[model samples]
Target: MKFGTMFTDILASFFKKNSTQLYPFEKNPTPERFRGNLYYDPAKCTGCCLCVKDCPSKAIELVTIDRAAKRFVLKYHMDRCVYCGQCALNCRFKCMGMSNKDWEHAALNKEEFLVYYGKEEDVREMLENISKPPAESEHK
Candidate 1:
């Protein structure tokens, strides 16, 4: 009985196609509306902070660059993000969305998970300004 079962299994294997996919060589098509990674467009963003507020995981951080000028630096912590798509849905300006292209978020360092979405100059200036000591007048 065992010999007969083994022979049947061997015959079936010859007719059936391999179920495994060659992942590195052959990529599978991502489904429509696939929530993979967060994408932000600074040009479309209005500095409303709606997306930040709506995020359930508290992964979104809005750093104020120039409040009077309505400038902001949007910080997205991929490590903390739950990928719930709530931030994109809450965005009134349609600046934030999920992209299927950047699903791979593997990194050796924790800092690598932090993604900033804003003007390059603004981000640099904000970092510099934060590092500086406050004026004596402000302390007084």
Candidate 2:
């Protein structure tokens, strides 16, 4: 290449604006179809377990509190989810879906990734059962 041509190119490049975004301070808007954090509505759930079956990653678990009473607890394993939106798509009652607003699931402990969605009393009871010692916990 000619010296004059190379010099001109360098001059033009120096005037170009930086093409970088200030992340952490500036958050880009999530797109309309963005598959993010998984959410569940226990009130809308019908204990069908359709969402659990459709999940390819097995990230979600449906715990039946009382099938006849329509009481259930959804255990969402965030770390295992692939954000494919499959569970939401297969749900006919609109009980499960991904939320664009709450996509941030950063955590240092693996336990934080396991989220429980259900009634206050039911969730408390389930948690108590899980925390019990192996000998005290029921086998079934």
Candidate 3:
């Protein structure tokens, strides 16, 4: 009886369509509202930290490069992200949102997860400022 059941199951499987997808070559379509990864637009950003404050995983970090100039850098850690879409909802400037097109975020190293979003000049200035000591007047 056991041998007959096993043989019948194998015969049935041969007539059925393949359930597994040929990933990497033939990809499956993602849903319309699928929250794949966070995307940041520096031009649309108002330097507001609402996204950072609302993130449940604390994956978003806003670094103020210049208060007067309203320059900021958005540090988005993909590894720590929960993809809840709260950040996009909380952002009043409409700078942050999720992109459904590119969801492949696999990384071999932890350092690859860290994404800095900002203007070229702003990022350069921020890096330069970080390397220098605070001025005496600013320290006061």
TM-score preference between candidates 1 and 3, better one: 1
TM-score of each: 0.80, 0.79, 0.78
Reference-based lDDT, each prediction:
0.85, 0.88, 0.85
Tell me the number of clashing residue pairs for each predicted model: 0, 0, 0
How does residue 36 of candidate 3 score in lDDT? Answer: 83
lDDT of 2 by residue, 15-131 (tens): 998677787677889998798998888988888888888888999998888878778889999999999999999999988878988897678999999999999888888889889
User: Which structure among the candidates has the greatest lDDT?
Assistant: 2
- Residue-by-residue lDDT tens digits, candidate 3, 6-105: 9999999999999988888888888889898888887677776888888899998988877567677888899999899999988888887898887897
- Badly placed stretches (over 4 Å) of model 2 are 1-18, 133-140
Query: Candidate 1, TM-score vs. the true structure?
Result: 0.80
Q: Model 3 Cα RMSD, Å?
A: 3.4
Query: 1-140 in candidate 1: lDDT tens per residue?
Result: 69999999999999999898897687788877898889887777677788888888999998877767757788889999999999998888888889987897778999999887788898888789879997778555
Weakest 10 consecutive residues, lDDT, candidate 3? 64-73
- Please tell me which predicted candidate would have the highest TM-score against the true structure: 1
| Candidate 3 residue pairs that clash | none
